[model samples]
Target: MVFFFLSGKFDQLQHAEPLSAIKTAFNQYFFNISKSDDERINTTRSSILETAGDCIRVLTACFPGLEKIIGSHCTNPTKVGPKETQHRFEYAFRSMVKAIATPSNPVVLFLDDLHWADAYSLHLLTVLATDAYSLHLLTVLATDREIKNFLFIGCLR
Candidate 1:
């Protein structure tokens, strides 16, 4: 079995990456397969963009691959209620995880230092974990044993 490990370490560098874990995972996945011109990958890219064009447009600034996949013509997503916005993010991320992970070659996302992880990263983790069973993906999270930061823990609830 092939296993891909994506590790994102959250440290004191707050200015380094805003959404550390999410940025790390997304960029890592894209970077690894960026050279491929496979038809299936192209199809997945198109499907993701068609299904979540607005969300992808918002994310292009963060993930460069989105811009390459969907081009620069995408406009800002329509302004929606908070719940609808959250749903869009969730759906986009779920599609991304499914695109990369497979039963034969599982992907593992290891996010360390949850205490230092931003609220957005923790929220994204919670969203992915909520749909873990269907994604065929594994997530490993770590933080200081003393549990000084309860923010990430609270996100699970």
Candidate 2:
């Protein structure tokens, strides 16, 4: 049996490599997988914080593998190409999500603050939601009601 434990109570036998600037930059504002331990400890109860922190750790594990794709921007620092950069980020983002998913374990991913999500995040959400329809994954979304023009707020008008 393959078990993917996303619990902080359990020590990770696998060690993750340090994050690159590109990977950290993307996750910083959107999902905050780079949130500090103090931040998590203060925001929630010990139990929840531990589990949440573990979730972040699990997600960020992919950053090490994605270093090449992300670090490419530095290698080509002369050109103006946010489009190509964003596409790579989106691909990396999805790959990170895939690392956390397990068909038998039924993992639930919660995405917060969608009301102000960047283009890459919104695109990734769309991709995940579509793929989730035929998989064991589940997504719980949160959005502020103030965003009257929010794409999912069609009836609020």
Top TM-score hit = 1
Please provide, for model 2 over 3-32, each residue's C-alpha lDDT reduced to its tens digit, 9 standing for 90 to 100.
222211101121122222223333332243
- Report the number of the highest-lDDT candidate: 1
For all candidates, the clash counts are 0, 0
Worst 10 residues of 1 by lDDT: 12-21
Candidate 1 has which clashing residue pairs, if any? Answer: none
lDDT of 1 at 138: 87
lDDT of each: 0.71, 0.39
* TM per prediction: 0.75, 0.41
lDDT of 1: 0.71
**Model 2 weakest 10-residue run by lDDT:** 6-15
Error of 1 at 62 (Å): 3.5
- Candidate 1 on 67-117: residue-level lDDT in tens? 665568877788999988778767767766765676775788888887888
Clashes of 1: 0
